[model samples]
Target: MELEGKVVVITGGSSGIGLATARMLLEKGATVVSWSRSRPKISHPDFYFFECDVRHEHSVWAAYEQTEERLRQNISVLINNAGLGIQGALDTMSPKDWLTMMDTNVNGIFYCTRLVLPGMKRMREGHIINVSSIAGIMGSENLTGYCASKFAVRGLSEALYKEVRDYGVKVTCLYPGSTDTGFFDNFEGVTSRENMMQPQDIAATIVHALQSPPNFHHVNIEVRPLMPKGPKSPKKA
Candidate 1:
């Protein structure tokens, strides 16, 4: 779909990938609405900020409703970028932490997607982009809960893709690997930001996906950094 003058809704737009995406989309002439619990640091004439907690259905509904009412148009794109990652061994993980991860990463997407689908279906032209992670594709030792949440996102995106294809609403699941964001701040595993992809890189990929012809749909995209090879070990004396 053409981006100019289109209405786009993005969750978790306060920072990181979501914020970067909002800037990029705005540059393309799309009207951008950002939903998050906290206010984002961006200010643009075409950018609208809505405080919302995607984990709650009512909050998600209100955010979308207000956007539609204000814009008087159906959303052209819905980007589910709000998520949380808690890393720890399964036995060491707290139930509250587990629930938080599931609620934010899994249920949040469901709430936002459910609210946006009817509008897109009515218009028969829209795109839904879910920001998942490479952890969803492969299991890691310390990311059991995080993996579970992201894996659920992958499943939800895949099923929703097939369900919405006939309606002219495309679904794209982004599985980005180790981007240099605060997502790794509380992570217990080793973090090498120097070798990680930048948030702008993911934003560019998302813009590229959105720029695809209406006839083409990219169901899934995985992005990873090109890490330099470690030095070879010398022969033992």
Candidate 2:
């Protein structure tokens, strides 16, 4: 389907890939709505921001209502891009931290997807893109909760494709490796921000998937920097 004039809702649109995707979608003439706790830094006539904490069902419902009422259009695309990262040893991790991560990374997607799906199914046309991560595909040390949440997203993508494809709704799951984002602000051990992929790169890929033929489904996409770390220099003696 053509992107022009389409309405897209992106979660976590305040920054990172979500923000980049919003800008790119607007450039394609698509109406964009950003759902996040913080306000976006940019502005456009076609861009709309809804302060929402997707982890809560009521918040999502309200946001959905406002989006539809304001735009007077059912969403053509829903991007489950909001995510939280809380990494630590399993034993060291607190229950609150674990719940918060799942609430943001998994439940938020769940709440958002459920609210928009009925309309999409009724329209018999829509796209749902869930952003997973490389962690979802591979386990990482001290990242049990994060990995579990991403894996859940991957599972949702897999199941939803089979469940919704017959209704003319396309489902895509993205598994991206380390990117230069605030996701790593509280963590350490990354090789270099310069070596990671940029948000715009992911944004372009998302638009490409959306532009695919109706019969085609990108399904799952896994992207990473070819060289995530530079070659090591000689060590000091």
Q: Whole-model Cα lDDT per candidate? A: 0.91, 0.93
Q: For model 2, what is the error of residue 162's alpha carbon versus the real structure, in angstroms, after optimal superposition?
A: 0.6
lDDT of 1 by residue, 1-237 (tens): 799999999999999999999999999999999989998888889999888998888898899888878889888899999998887899999999999999999999998888888989999899999999999899988889999999999999999999999999999999999888889887675556778888899999999999899889999999988772323588999
Best by TM-score: 2
Candidate 1: the clashing residue pairs are none
TM for every model, in the order presented, reads 0.94, 0.96
Q: What is the number of backbone collisions in each predicted candidate, taken in the order shown? A: 0, 0
C-alpha root-mean-square deviation, each candidate: 2.4, 2.5
lDDT (10s digit) by residue, model 2, range 145-174: 999999999998899899999999999999
Measured with C-alpha atoms, the lDDT of residue 164 in candidate 1 is: 93
